[model samples]
Target chain A: MQVCKKCLLNDNMPSVRINEDGLCNLCSTQYESRGIVNNNEEEISSLIKANREEKYQIILAYSGGKDSTYSLKMIKERYDASILAVTFDNGFLSDTCLKNIRTVTDNLDVDSIIIKYPAKKIIRAFKYIEDGKFFPRQSMERASAICNMCIMLIKNLIYYEAIIRRIPIICFGWTPGQVMTSKPLIKLNYTMVLKGFENIKNIITSRFGARYEKYFLDDAFMRENEANMPYLYYPFVKNNYKEDSVIEEIKEIGWIPPQNTDGNSSNCLLNSYANQCHVSKFGYHPYAFEISNLIREGYLTREEGLTKIGNVANPCSYKMICEQFEKITG
Target chain B: MNIQAVNEKLKEFFENNFLYGESFDDINGDESLIDKGYVDSIGIISLVAFIENAIGIKVYDSEIVPENFDSINSIYAYLKKKMNTQDKAV
Candidate 1:
């Protein structure tokens, strides 16, 4: 399939088109708007200082992924706030990922907490997914469909932990490319985000039984009070750094690639499967959404986006995913 | 018998639960919903749950589709019709 000349977008993607001059949806938006924007670093720095002046203990949603690692490092180096690095082991991380978590946490002098789901429940969840008999209707056409479920659970855990520890600022290392950083940090609206999860919970409850509801849902009162803070990606929205350079700079902070993983994944093996399934079903890798958004925002060019696509997912991973699915289902 | 009441209930449910963009105030009851940009396909399941929660109605898995949510008027009209049928069946 022909890729968009301007961004990582492919011609076959649903509802996306490249104009004759080769501008993708994202780049075209920027072109029409006259230019892109980069926020003032001094402003961001002053905001961080003002926010952290209370000596709040920062709860970092550490995924053991490179992005979160960079986030942890930034929060530690910049704010010098006491940081807690927490990872939710979804029962499928490669052995190397666990080792990297240890290495980075120790090097950064940050306290680490690792939470793992019960093996039986995770296996049952995996089997349910593999059976091809049950799937959440919302999962289609997205990369990380299964990972999304895991993330939802992890998010609830973080919120609960934040409340219990009285940690006011809950930080996750989401990059600008992942979710737009139009607004960096805002107080949580449990009602709005919670409502989105309700129907998805019904599907999960029906398939895996209602026993899992508490893990996937958060208390309303806590969400309304605690702050939701995200850092690394929004800065990129303003400065528009090359991913390679950011990855390189962070490597000096003792970041290392996990063994048996490719450039597309510096952290999770499950990501490869999710991306492959999304591409097979949707005719394009799911990363196209983020890449297209970045390109539209003038942070990256069409060629740059397409080049990065090769690094995010590999089709070959599908063979292993199919084998694993069959094994679980059997 | 509760069709109009059901419509009012669903409208209230949408406002209370659903978050729309800045243009939400411009939403008219009769316009095409997806065309008018109220919610995407992803919002449909949530809408189903909202109807179930508000109207105390049950919609089968097969009945979930664009036709049921094409417009606010359509959603209002459908809930009214379905709930009436349901009242009779009961």
Candidate 2:
């Protein structure tokens, strides 16, 4: 339970070493001196501006969360870019998030697409992860069970939509902590590495049948046309926007807080359950590194990050998650 | 650079950076670092960075495939080939 003095990382966190000064190795290691650039608003704005003249300028992977809602609003109002917002309904969305999605997109006057996976499919995927049949064991040190699979599916669908529509920019609401430090605007060629998930795809195909391939891998299209892929952009990661201000700005666009989700998440009901499972099995919160990154970058305070991740799952949500898991596994 | 020097350098980099200063003796040079739970996707990224900086070679997106990066032996072989190609071009 011993936490880092400088960041929210605890002693239980994998790959962390606490020094005599009570600072985690990540804090003491002079990561900034490694030559990774911090948030550069000018570079991000220029990238957005350069893409603005293109047709269907941005395809935002919108999750109806506060960060994405703010991103959607920013793309429309700030850059005046034509945007297509796509939401992947993973069968665990809060009602408020759904309402927020409809209200915000309607207000923004942007085209929106919702790709809803069947509840059974999502449950089955989770079951595989839960049974340790999916994902690399080392990955558990970084990501949650639901997140590893869910993000893969979302990214694939987004890439597919962007390629088909010839959208030049694929914007995500990823924070600085979520992305590699070298760049915020990644070339499409590099983003196509998701296609290399051969082991995960094989597992899904064997366990859940080949139907999962449609969602997880767009092999035919990717093979024939991956060269024509769009650039991946992370606006939130590049700009120094305060979280409170982002919430407030999105509130003007009809975004509301959900009652069912954990403090760290605003859209998905499954996040708390996922956090619970991650902590139970791995002895650390899956989001600890992400939250710690936020703290290190001064985006969030150490105490706030700790409080946000600590004991996020409630009994009611836990019961609901168990029931859903049972129905899907059966 | 000689293969022995390159191999020694790679071992040092992986041990110092990825393994958190742990000795590389426990890991096999030919075994899959990923399958052995020694590296993940993020670890691959860091390893790529280390190669570019420490080995003085640039890894392209196409070279990120498992054939080139799944194991210490694979990485050393890929580096040797790339270096030879660079030398020939010069």
Local distance difference test values of all predictions, in order: 0.58, 0.73
Best by DockQ: 2
**Lowest-lDDT window of 10 residues in candidate 1 chain A?**
A30-39
Estimate the TM-score of every prediction.
0.67, 0.82
| Model 2 alpha-carbon miss at residue A230, Å | 1.9
Docking class of 1: incorrect
Which digits, one per residue and each the tens of the lDDT, describe model 2 over residues A1-330? 677899877767556778899988668763322333444445546655776766677899999998889889987886657889999998888899999999999999998989998888778887777634356654565568778777777887888888888787788887776654344555535323553465677778887787878876456667777677677677775578578899888888888988878877899888878888888886788888788778888888977888878856766777898998987686
lDDT value, candidate 1, whole model: 0.58
Clashing pairs in 2: none
- Candidate 2 per-residue lDDT, tens place, B11-57, comes to 76665345654677776779877666567665676566556545556
| Model 2 spans with C-alpha error above 4 angstroms | A33-55, A131-133, A188-196, B1-22, B29-38, B42-90
